[model samples]
Target: MTTHTDFRAFRIHNDAAGYRGGIETMNTAALSAGEVLVKVAYSSVNYKDALAGTGKGKILRQYPLNGGVDASGVVVASTDPKFKEGDPVLCTGSGLSETRDGGYGEYIRLPSTWTIPLPTGLSLRESMILGTAGFTAALALLRMQDNRQTPALGPIAVTGASGGVGMLAIDIFSRAGYAVHAISGKADHFDVLRNLGAVECIDRHQLVFSGKPMDSARFGGALDNVGGAMLAGLLPLIEPYGNVAICGNAGGIAFESTVMPFIIRGASLLGIASAGTARDLRDQVWQHLASDWKPAHLDRIATREVTLEQLPEVFGRMLAGDSFGRTVVRVGKV
Candidate 1:
């Protein structure tokens, strides 16, 4: 139904100095060549987006790239048999915002193989609200469950509990009848974590290691978004045969950890990589998020909605570790 060729986007450019993102008018055809073109309705900000936008991390290996890892919208055209004109689709990761154009734009052309029909029971906005962060959170839980993690075991600890992935993990574990202990550096957001179903909250500083090889068992399992000392400290305290899903590295990437936990406690470390997930697993996770694993307080979890022009400010807030919950960008109306 839309005929516009040039649309607005938040594009990042790399030059002799560094990377920078700003609003610009871009041609639909200028997007990377692909089988399907989508009119983006919504996208969400993640830690990676902030890294790409501000050059805080080495995420974008290419220059002049559109930088949003998650997007959901109605399909405009498709040359592939799997998708047709006017079909609603969602795409996240799969090299988006990295090797190809991404979702910070009003329009994005992506390979048909990378697109999935928006799962039933979730709107375009809702899908983006969950975004890559929420998807990773759900995937972590799913992996833990597959490894025999159960609600009856003991409390599940979620690190970086105020961040996007951490908050959703708290909600999912709580809804699944597990007691969740949220660990956060932002002590002020303790009440928010509690409202999101975290039964107890702990400060990040309290999770530092004390050079001990092992500690008293505390958590049955853990969804850890913070790496480094937090992760190292948590390993020795997990119950036997427990799983720890390692996702983010908001804390420093390096940490010294001993093998005592794995050898003695039988704790397994599960790595969650949303970027290279298999299509079958990605589809299954999305379905689960739309059905049984969907967070009940999505509106509350989404604390802010900003236009493309307001993204720089949001990125600043995120990098300062001041933003909480999800921030969705309104690209267009579905």
Candidate 2:
């Protein structure tokens, strides 16, 4: 590999008035001070990344910060005795792209605690394909399982089935022997969702309610990616003692609901915040995704690969809700 004093990155700048992000060249020394510096091979786009890249959300508190939440690559240098040069590693969440210069650049420097040895059986490219979204999905599934959710409890519902987390959740749940019901606004992608192991697909409109506080029980549990009414609608339908893993707030954050489900039915609503999870837990989830929980169709699920220069257009597509599955960003040939 060729080493250069400076490399390209997509950085976000914020001032007293505004925020903006675009491509720029940055020196390796410009990276945030950390114990390890990595030559990033691959990164993946997330909804948070799109929000940060376009200044749609206040995701980055620091100005002139490199922006990417997920990166997988080989270590180029390390002060931590546990890691050495050329070791493959991946980093996600743990305040990446928010408090530190993240993976959008060719090189990223981060504390050793933020890095995980790339799990065996997953290549750097495949690991980036799972990225933070897949990890969140896996964590959600594992949480539900720990809560005693099982395939014998009837069908499990997954909201936002067309997005990265939803798609992966569908694949994971289906493979785990549960009947999968995918909820999506994009009826056009019904076939694709089915191919990902959704036994059935429900249109988002079908879940909409007109002031009703409760609906007929339909699912044993749910993995909800879209919040708001979709989540509110889901609560009443969970079987007694069923679990709902709440992850994203893409649809909206607020929803009105009563406590009938939890109070009367004894249902559990589990919140999944992959970003701030303990490092050991994160490592365990990565191990699960690399082994027993690994999706069988990873290569088929990833929809596109683009270079760093192509990110702006991709970000625009994602913001418009026109993208699907995973979009891996190739920072350097790997």
Candidate 3:
């Protein structure tokens, strides 16, 4: 039996004046009521979590909430027969950082239905390394494949290529036999992108959309993390029957574009919202991520790991666009 009564958490509070967040020592009993109590081993920081923690965007629906969107750990207590003590598991999205207390803490209480057993090929650390970002990339690939994307079709492009999802997508797309074209604003990261399996690294500025409604085809498909003008420019360049998955709005949310790319070339614009994915599809995607879809450069993709106390600074860096790759938080031990 353990005698731990208090643990550290990164919590955010909103007030009449403004919002503030920091690491706080919290009582274990104060965790919100749920069917399962998890001793979080690791949690990865997402762009959404950065917004919630730093108040850059309206991510938290409530005040004084724990602020992490992804966690993996062992179950410490459970009221559901689907889980038991000592089971390794993880939960992503399912209203974390928006509707309830999330996984920025040493302990988390979550509905068992949101929990997933750690798949056979992934360890607790490995799962959090992939977290929501890698999962989103894999989900996008699955959707693209479902729409008939194949390795022989042509090169696949990944925008925001230095970030977590982009890095993982590059590796997975290359490993799956697709030629990956990585596009990013960070010139310094071009070599890093190539090391992660991108066959071509193009600067984001290299893409100058011709004013024409539809330009010549370039890529077979794309995983687009930066939205707005970049996305608008990309649409005109996709080959016929190509699909582009839109997952992030780090750039401006709105863009000006003609419908010629969609109507004339049969290109698809896929919207990927990872937070509300159905449980069955989530299970399927995670299983694939653990098995064949797992990237060969997971360790390379996980660039940094910080403790609970260091999360606030990390969030600041993320919001400033100064951070890259994936940063996992060490919340507790296995």
Q: Give lDDT per model, in order.
A: 0.89, 0.88, 0.88
Model 3 C-alpha lDDT versus the unseen true structure: 0.88
Could you tell me how far off, in angstroms, the CA of residue 80 lies in candidate 1 after the best superposition? 1.3
Off by over 4 Å in 2: 1-4, 16-18, 208-214
TM-score of each: 0.96, 0.95, 0.96
TM-score of 2: 0.95
**Candidate 3 residues 1-334, lDDT tens each?**
2423688889888987679988888876777667888899999998888888888889888878889999999988888999989999999998887888899988988988889999999999899989999889988988888888888768999999998889989987887789999999998999989998999999887767786778888999899999988888888999988999999887889978888988998899999988989899899889988888888888888999999888878989988889989999889887
Off by over 4 Å in 3: 1-4, 16-18
Q: In candidate 2, what are the lDDT values of residues 39-134, reduced to their tens digit? A: 999999999999999898889877889989999999888889999899999999988899999889989997899889999989999998899988
Model 2 weakest lDDT span, ten residues long? 206-215
Model 1 misses residue 165 by how many Å? 0.7
- Candidate 1 per-residue lDDT, tens place, 1-334, comes to 4434998899999998666789999888789888898999999999899889988888987888898999999888888988988899999898888888889999999887789899898988889889998899998988999999998779999998999998888888888789999998889999999999999999886656566889888899999888888888888889998999999887778878989999998889999998989988999899988888889889989999999899899999999988999999998875
Model 1 per-residue lDDT at 94: 86
Q: Given candidate 3, what's the lDDT at residue 155? A: 95
